[model samples]
Target: MTVKPGSIHALLGGNGSGKSTLIRILAGVERADAGQIDIGGAQFAAHSFNAGLAQKNEVHVVHQHSSTFPHLSVAENLSLGRGYEASIGGRILWPTVRERARRVLARFGIGASPDQLLSSLRPAMQTMVAIARALQDQEGSATGLLILDEPTATLSSAEVARLADALRRYAAAGQTIIVVTHRLDEVLDLADHVTVLRDGKVAGDLPREEVTHETLVQLIAGNSLPVSENRGQRRLAGRVLLQASGLCVGPLANMDITLGAGEVVGIAGLVGSGRTSLLRALFGLSRVSAGTMLFDGAAYGPADPADAVRHGIAYVPEDRLAEGTFPGLSVVRNVSMANLDRYWKIARLRTKAENRDAAAVADLVGLRPRRTDLAINQLSGGNQQKVVIGRWLLRKPRLLLLDEPTQGVDVGARADIHRLVRGAVSEGASAVVVSSDFSELAELCDRVVVLNRGRVIADVTADELTSDNLQQLAHMRIAA
Candidate 1:
């Protein structure tokens, strides 16, 4: 694969399709087994390229997490990888650092003050700060090959547009960029060229004018149908399973939601829109200051996660690596961790029974390699998510609260997970899903509840559900 100078190139692929691995190789975070790299008429062996070489070649990277210290000022964050200006007496030159930060922020159109804490800015502005810091040279000019991984994943639609415009301006000024993103609309609007990876290989490479949304999806997913297809056939049982009335929690105002038996309800919102807060409140991770909840025709207010579990509620958090999985443990242990009491018999753990149940769940989730003994971290992001969801499926809870269940998974694995959720619901369970991906919510949910500043502005049924509609509703401002 080749990237031309002075062009915005998009690196497109499904999860586990070699996108992250390739990015790591280019950024010198990982060594490639065999390959050659060409940078500005210079050639180097891929294996010999290290962080030092990448820096010397003007290669810079900004990750999805932004890699910024929230508590630190914007000037401090900009001065991180690069050294600070120091006086002859070894005192740091604060004015010099702030001046340099101001120039870079202005050049990138980032609406952030140099002295302001990074956490004080909006999510989009924080991402722009990271990008500006990466692309800015010592001369305060954008003059390098910048690579960004999922930079807009957390931003709202309007914020994404602003960032895309900044990138376009940078590319026009002869700065080469490689953007790794899952959103196809971003590729169409921002990229000059596109390279797609599938199963660790280049599946397609096309010019921007030659690519369309359908063609890109076909390249990334191959022949497998999208999970969104066949949404018309799914039917929800006409019985309410869970209900919340005037629910008030952190960032959540008088919100009301109802989940039907064998139904999947989606919560759609921007950052801090109370999507995750709703899930946490239901899972008993957050205290509900006011309001009432009913589950299966009974008043339900779980004191804690253990209490929620005892009451037959399961929650899959948004950050799977941080909250869902035990990194070093085997798939079997991770799957059975939530329900260990089932294997405890007479003060002795029933290893065989645990393994048997885990294996069944692995099969149910279509876990690749079919090895329950493998470490949970060994699996790809998609499979790791599968293991996390499988853990909840093993217990067969009455109401499942999934926060971004398919956030970083591949198309195939996403379909598998959606099928698994639908199957569980078909067996009389109910689900409340929170996802930033509007398309996923439109496809997988029977009804979508749109939240803005913690209030339910719209509840859209499946017949009226579409990615565009969800986005429009979430961005709408309603008078209090």
Candidate 2:
């Protein structure tokens, strides 16, 4: 697929559909076996492209998890890529660096101070900082190609709009952009031209006017995906399995929520709205300083994750790469790690039993490659997520806490994950899912707890839940 100059080209595909590989090749992180690459009027054999060559050709990329230093100041992060302003005496000029950073931030409409820590900003602002840093040397010119991978995956709707506006301004100024994302709405809203990839080949290419959400999904999946049957009729009528009253954890203030047995409840809120905090608190990652919790008709408060696990609670964190999977461990080990006691026989680990159980869990989660011996890190984002979820599913936890379970996974993997979660819920497990994707909440949840500034603003029932309505509620500010 060819990207036109001065256009916002969207690269769409499922997991392992070669989108990441293609991006890596363009960014010079990976060598292509046999292909040709053309940037501007220059052509190079794909195998010959390297980091140095990509840099010389002015190709800049901001990955899904940006490589910005959180502990450092924005000025420092911006200066790291492009060298610092130094004097003849070899001393770094702090004032010059700050001024340049301010200029770049303003040019990109980023509302962040140069002296502020990169981590201090919200997810969207941090993303804008990364984008500004990527284009700092270009000075708003149209000379370089900017590639952003899954930039809006973790951002809220409002945050996504903010970033989309910035990108549109950049594209309007002739700065060419290629956005590789799993978000269909982003493609519909931001892309000038769309290219869908399937199994490492271009599936379809269409202009923005010719693209709809349905058409895009069809192209990405290589066929029309089955519409999820309406689950709104399934109301929360089961026994309350987990209930929290006046819950107070980090960023969570006086929040109250109830989860029914065999129910999937979604936590909806913008960044800093305590969506993840609720999950962490429930999973015993955070202490509830002031609250009353009831688990299965008993007063419950887990001291830690192990205690929670003993009480049949499982958590899947948002940043799967950093928090979920063990890098060098095999899928079997990862799956069995949560419940090692199940395989402990007379003080000796039962390897065969562990592998047997892990294989069953892998099949249940529909893990790709169907190999339990491969390192969990070797799998794609979706497959890695499946492994992580499968690991927890092996425990048959009573309460499942999922934070952005389908954040970066492809459409097919997402459906598979939803199916797995629903199947578990059907078998007497309850779930509390925290997600920025409103549509996901609408699809998988029987009820939604909407948070605003750490307060429970709305408890939307299934009949009233819709993606658009959830987005609105998340952005609303109710008077205390």
Candidate 3:
């Protein structure tokens, strides 16, 4: 496939669709056994990093996570590839480095000063700094390439717009850009051409004018995804299973929440708006400074997570990698970790019984490639999440809490997760979910509680809750 010069091309696909492999090949991190790479119409062996280095001045790559040293200044990050400014006597030249950083910042129209620490910048600004550093080595090259992988995965819509604007400036400056992302709106908004991959091959390649969101989704999933379900139609029994009033926990102030039996309630808010904090509090991961809570008609103050779990409360944390599942354990082990008591007999572990139960729950949660012995880290993000959430499902928990349930999940896996959640609710489990994706809340929740600055500003029921409604409510609260 030939990419147009000076165009912004979006590479999109579901997880495990070889998008990352292709990128690795392009970035010279992997050697291709077959086929050759042609950069600017010049053919090179796709066997090693040497080929990539031959065109080093013309190609730059910025990954999803910033590689910049947080404690260092922007100037230091920019001077990493290029030599640092040093005197003949081997003294560092801060002025020269800062001046160089200022020139690159000016070229990119970034407002950050060279001496400013990278960690002090906003996420969007830090991303811009990374991009600026990538371009610094190529200085005045008009026919260069900039590749960004999932640049806005963690950013809000507003921050995404800022990053898009910076990328557009690079494209306008005659740099060919390739962005690898799963976000459809971003592809439509920023890409001149879109390429979809499926099963290690290109499925669809279309110009910006030819692709719509529906078409892109179809290409990615290879089928029609289910329409958003009418959450209001689901009957939620009004038996309150969990209640909190005057709840205050680590930046959350006087928050009130009510969760009925078999109901899925979503907490919607921007980053740093106490969404995750509230989930942590509900799951007993955080200490409540002052609050009143009742669980199953009894006082609910968990001394720790163990107390919460013993009381039939299960939590799926936002950072799946760090807090949700143990990566080194097998899928069966991870699934059964929460219910080991069931498989323990006096002095010995019932391994066969544990595996049987783990396999059963794995099937129920629709865990793909259902191998009990595979390491949890070997599974995709969605499968790992299923293992995490599925652990609680086996326990017949009275309450479940999920934070960013599908943050980095692909469309197919996300659908599977939603089906699992609905199945759990059908079995009468009460759940509280926290997510930044408004559409996810609108699709899954019976009610959405919008938070702004640690306070509940609106409790929108399913019938009244649309993506636009949630966005407007949250934005207006912030504006107010």
Candidate 4:
């Protein structure tokens, strides 16, 4: 198949459909055992980064989790590809450098100052900074190719619009843009051409205007998934497992909340809202400057994560690779991580017999066929997610914190995760889930609390929940 340049092309498919694999190959990070790359009408060697570099700085890729020094300032990050710091006879200056940084950021609608550290920004803000680098390098340069792999997975809809606009401008500026995303709506709006990959090869190809949503869904997912609406009403009056009064942090405040045993409260918000921070404050990752937390009818605000875990409060963070799964360890080890102290014998490692028992728990969580010997990376994406969730479920927390737990998961895996979460609650675990998906909040939550910017805007029960309602509440300007 022949591909063209300077067009907004998309690789559309479900989870494990080889979208990411293709991206890795194109980005010069993965070697395709057999195919050659042709950039700007010139065929390059099959497995060579030098060839990629030779093609006029051909490609730039942005991944799901960022790769940067977290402590570095935004200027430092943007300057990674485009130089801002100069030798200048061994002298350093700030204002002139940051002035250039601001000008570059405006090109992509990032709108952030240079002196701010990357650790201070949200994921979307960080992404904007990253995208600005591409723009910076492309100015008067020959960067003809760009690859985006799941770029909008963690972004809110509004941020997606901004990022999409930025990419569209880049394409209009005569660069080839290739996107890989499961978000069909984005594909419908932003793509000029679409390619569906099923197993390892192209399943179908269609021009953008020719592709309809239903037809695109048919190509990627084949058939729609079953929407399980069999959930019973939340009992609503079990013993209070967790209560937070006046929970105040950087962007979260006046968050008086109470969760009973078996209850699941979902906080829906946009990208910059304080849902994750709120969860962190409760889990002791973020400092709750002013709040009183109560667990099991007792006053409880732990000094740190260790104490929080000891008190049976678990958090599954938004950045799964960074905060959830241990990619370096075995499947048994990753799943049994949260409560490793349970299997330990006074500072010494557990015996092979105990390790095998951990593998049995892994099997219970549907990570079978490959056991303790298998590396955690060997499992498929869905199975990896199951292992991460199960690791915490095995801890039997009184309160679970789930932040965008289903972000990168496919529809089937999302349904399975929802089922698993509800199962955990049925077995008497309470949870607070933070999701950017309004549809998911309206579906799985017993009660929905919408946070806009930094404060609660609306609190609605499942009886009053709808996708439109949650979206409105999440986007509304609530009076401080």
Pairs with steric clashes in candidate 4: none
In the range 1-480, model 3's lDDT, one tens digit per residue, is 668988999998765678888877787777788787778877777775453464563677789866888898889988887778999998989899899889999988888999889889888888999888877766687666778888876676688899899888888888899999766667888999999997798999999899888777667656423337544355555788888999998557899988899889989865556788777877778988999999978998988888999998899998889888889999888987899888889999899988998889888878888887999999999899988988888998888888888878998888888887888888878888888677788888888999875789999984677765665555442432
Give the TM-score comparing model 1 with the true structure, all chains together.
0.65
Candidate order (lDDT)? 2, 1, 3, 4
Model 1 misplaced regions, further than 4 Å: 87-90, 138-142, 225-239, 243-281, 284-294, 298-311, 325-397, 402-480
Winner by TM-score: 1
Q: Give the alpha carbon lDDT tens digit for every residue of 135-225 in model 1.
A: 7673544555799988886676687888888888888878899998866767888888999998799999999889888778678766532
Clashes of 1: 0
Clash number for model 4? 0
Question: Which segments of model 2 are wrong by more than 4 Å?
Answer: 224-281, 286-294, 299-307, 316-321, 324-480
Candidate 2 global CA lDDT score: 0.85
TM-score each candidate: 0.65, 0.63, 0.61, 0.64
Per-residue lDDT, model 1, residue 150, is 86
lDDT, model 3, position 1: 62
Tens digit of per-residue lDDT, candidate 4, span 1-480: 445677889987644568877777776777777767777766777667443464355577767665766799988887775565666674545677788788787766675778889889876677767766655756654356677777886666677787888778777877778887766667888999999986566778999779887676566544423333754456584888888888888677667888878888999876556788888888889888887888898888888999999998888888888788888888777866787776777787675745776666566565645566677777777777877887788877778899988887777778778877888888888889998766677678888888776777788884567665664455454443
Question: How much is the lDDT of residue 79 in candidate 2?
Answer: 95
The lDDT values for all models are 0.84, 0.85, 0.81, 0.74
State in Å the error of residue 159, model 4.
14
